[model samples]
Target: VNTHGNTDFRNLFSQLIQKPEEDLELDRAALYLAGEEYPEVDVLSHLAQLDAFAAQVSQRVTHETAPANLARAIADYLFGELGFDGNSGRYYSPENSFLNRVLETRTGIPITLSLLFLEVARRLGVRCSGVGLPGHFIVGLDDTGEYLDPFNAGAPLSMEDCRALVDRMSAGSLEWTDQFLEPYTKRDILFRILNNLKAVYMQGREYTKAVGVIQRMSIISPGLPSLYQEQAWCHAEQQEFRLAIGTLEAYLQEAGTPDDSKEVKDQIKGLWSTLSRLN
Candidate 1:
């Protein structure tokens, strides 16, 4: 990646995060995240496509359309007409995590599908938001208190169904809690998307990509000390010892004697010794 391009994206992403929650543009932020891997992505063109989707939906509904009917219409339009569905076969594919790919392929995991649903709903004046369930994600209609599972052909889910979904997804290990159904803020959604990317990159042994995801996470949660540790791990995996040590030091500075301080100090010493031997 070009250093100038990196600086420009950082500044742009930081500005997006600084916006008021109401004004934070989730679609723009999401496309920018996708640009990390697909640097040539045209964000505006994708956004315009979303506009076209909303325009079509507008023709089917009037200003007085009920929220429930509106939700159904959107589900039908997106899933039935567009054929957007979950990519159950390759759930972990990095493509499933990127909005642009999801738009083009009409297949994505729960979060990306839910994001697409939310964006289309947003354009139509619907108060829909993402419900970040453990091991699952869905869209919630703020007006009707209903949840829609975009991954499952936009199936409308009752509260009981949602609880059962959590049970099944976790094999009953996670206890049901009302908090699980709470709507995630735009920033929270962005963080979750990055968190998914971080895992996929790490599992694929793409340490550099994992580090990039962590850097973006830092922009969203600047005071998050654990991010420094995670980034350091990625750097160490890539054999960037000095960079890893600096990251760990920054972790210590932000964490200020976290419980793992002693272990971290030992790790830093070991890295330094390795660096010396290399010299």
Candidate 2:
């Protein structure tokens, strides 16, 4: 496929990947990724919108000193007043993956909603982290260990609430583990968001956008071998044979002796034969 030159995305990825993994800002980096889908979006302007929202939330939080109370206040403001809620009908919609659209529509899937909650909490001096709880993402404060499912009108979630979500996501075949409560690192959060965006694109057969998403995912977290293979697949689907061949080669370097490596090796050989025929 013909490459879509995205200089702004290139610069954003370069700047983000260079930062120490721990210090990478999940909120801002994710905004940039959403900005990729909307070339004309002014990311800084949306940031200002977040700042303004947080400031308004800060006003209602004056008398609420406890963490849980503050969290409830913020949730009431966001979900109750602002009308933010999960988009249950269209789970895989690309618009659900874009922050700008989420702001306008006040609807999104778990991760995007979680991201907005995380950012607002951080700005308001609330202690919170992103929980990549299996198939659904949630937010938790530092002190209370209390969870909030942002997708569900910022509803407070007990362990039972979490278990129910896990069961539903797994079709009642899986149970909750302690892993469900663990907070995701910033890099982890950003990577998952990109993965969500890529999945939506792939489902729509939008290979160009999927490739671009994986390209960003690869840069942000270079050690993920699966991303290289994904990039290769997208390139192959687009008939960018040479680029596909190169990406598959890169994936094999990271594959080692895994069972999947042999399959990838066969793919590379087939791609090479196709390349020769084209020549």
lDDT of 2 by residue, 145-260 (tens): 78999999888898888888899998988766888788888788878888898898998999988988888777777747788788888888888888998887777776666667
lDDT per residue as tens, model 1, 1-279 = 212125556667778999999999999999888886777889999999999998998899988999989989989999999999999999999999889999999999999999999999999998998999999999999999989999999999999999999999999999999999988999999999999989998999988878888888888888586787888888888789999999888888878788889999999999999889989
Candidate 2 clashes between residue pairs 3 or more apart in a chain or in different chains: none
Where in model 1 is the C-alpha error above 4 Å? 1-5
Q: Give the top-scoring candidate (lDDT).
A: 1
Q: Cα deviation in Å at residue 12, candidate 2?
A: 1.7
- Whole-model alpha-carbon lDDT for candidate 1: 0.89
What C-alpha lDDT do the candidate models reach, one value each?
0.89, 0.83
Clashes of each: 0, 0
- Clashing residue pairs in candidate 1, if any? none
RMSD of each: 1.9, 2.3
- Name the 10 consecutive residues with the lowest summed lDDT in model 1: 1-10
